[model samples]
Target: MALPEPGADRRTLDADRATAVPTMRSAAPLLKTSTAGALLAIAVMVAATVGAAIWLSIIDQRRQAQEQLTRQAHAAALQIRARLIETEQLLLLEGSGYAASADRFRRDMEELLDANPALLRVELRGRDGQSLVGVDAAAPRPTVAAATRTALSPEAAAAFDSAARMNRLTYSRPYYVTFGATGFDLMELVVPTGAVDGPMIVAVYAPQRILDHFLPSDQ
Candidate 1:
């Protein structure tokens, strides 16, 4: 090939440079657009991730709260069960003394009431479902009024009958009763004397006592 002039070579290089500049300028907008799109995608992804995290955190918190409530309920139930068992034992012990001396039986019941402030009433009922000897916390004195009184409710009657028939300890569902000036729900625990022809021991208890034992005052 024949050698070209230096000036011609310079002019050719200048023209090529001029064309390249415009090409680069034309591509700048696409580069900027791609960069902006990438940034927007990153922002959207970050927002989605953060929102998911917050939602998961809320769900987790709710789950934890439910678990805590469940634990509190279970603990409260256990405490109430234990208290009822103790009361049953106390009633059994006192009921056995009824045949020995009426005075002694009354004294023992009084002592039990004193020991357990949550005990609203204790009754020794005959096989006929007649209260033979009863001590009400409100009265403290032995009374036969409960003897003539029928079942507190159908549920209470069922609980009593179940205990007598099964010859085992049974509990009534929570029912509202007035104690002193305040009214709250309480449950009755029945302990059969195991003598199909004999009496049964029934004790009324405050459920709040068990909750107080298992939970904080604020709760």
Candidate 2:
């Protein structure tokens, strides 16, 4: 106990060195495993980030596609409205001596029907709701404006009266037409004849034809 043997001390140092060597060897495997686990976590994060980006891109593309379709549809709608306004103006002009004679009026109506296939009938009616000039696209033109006398439905009467009273063009509500092409709706436009008591020009339109002419074919 007073003085340790030099050889004993050397053996003790050797034993301690052997123990430390195994501890370092064991620690190396743990370090390698920790590094590998860290790399795997990083790889998973990268994959998840990429997937999310792809999903977002797809969503953005769909949104842009929908917006483009909506814009196209809106443009088509504007064109349809412009066409309707033009037709109304034409009717009003025709009533203002564009066709002075009854024969001339009937001829003009026939021409209009021929030009626009969407029109089913065109009539010039007095303020009292009497048809002054009536022409059908499917049939021959009437002999004279006063040749035929027929009672109008309630809706037509109201529209014609309103147009005369308001001194402006009036639109009749949509109605189902049984005469031409089964199962279709028609809308009538009544335009004032300039004078307050003058006859009105009524034009019957086919909605499906109007859409087909104005809207995109693919849509």
Candidate 3:
């Protein structure tokens, strides 16, 4: 009466195990689906973060490139202006010498041409368009009429005419020229001698010289 049946206890334990196994098996698929969903969400977040970083990097690079180009342009402009000022000063000194003596003016022109090879030619013109003193006579001469009509823009020509009438130093726009074996863009400057009806100085300069002086060789 007091002893339980061994087979009966074994059967009851086997039933309990069978019921627990199915319950565990039923919950496993739901757990697996939740884990997969979590993994997919993490992957999407990582990809979105990487894409945003790449786009921002491209924008930053473009901005830096634009800034560098702007700096180079500004530096080039300043160098050109400085060279023009230097040419103006030289022309003023020569104009004074021209007024004093014809021989002295010729000597000064020769020296200028020797000192600065960038200066291709120099011409002094009297009130009646007569050539007073000239250097590099073999080189093609620059004419104001041609400059105003074709070589220079209308705005530049107008500016040149106004500056000439007021007896002021003025430079023309860049024009192409070939002297002997060398060819380059040339700029002309007309410097007044303070006498409206007196002789004026015309000086031709190469802009490549200014660039060679200021810019890097690789550029």
Off by over 4 Å in 2: 1-14, 17-40, 110-118, 128-151, 178-181, 195-197, 216-219
Winner on lDDT (1 vs 2):
2
How much does candidate 3 score in TM-score? 0.60
**Reference-based TM-score of each model:** 0.68, 0.70, 0.60
User: Where does model 1 exceed 4 Å of error?
Assistant: 1-6, 110-118, 138-155, 158-187, 192-198, 205-219
lDDT of each: 0.73, 0.75, 0.68
Which 10-residue span in candidate 3 carries the lowest summed lDDT?
141-150
- Using TM-score as the yardstick, the better of models 1 and 2 is 2
Best-matching candidate per lDDT: 2
Q: Which RMSD values do the candidates have, in order?
A: 4.9, 5.3, 6.2
Q: What's the lDDT for residue 144 in model 2?
A: 19
Ranking by lDDT: 2, 1, 3
lDDT of 1 by residue, 1-219 (tens): 988876998899999999999999999999999999999999999999999999999999989988888887877778766866677776666555664456776777778777775676777777667777777765542222464345555656789888888888888998766535656777788887655567787777777765655653324
Measured with C-alpha atoms, the lDDT of residue 174 in candidate 1 is 88
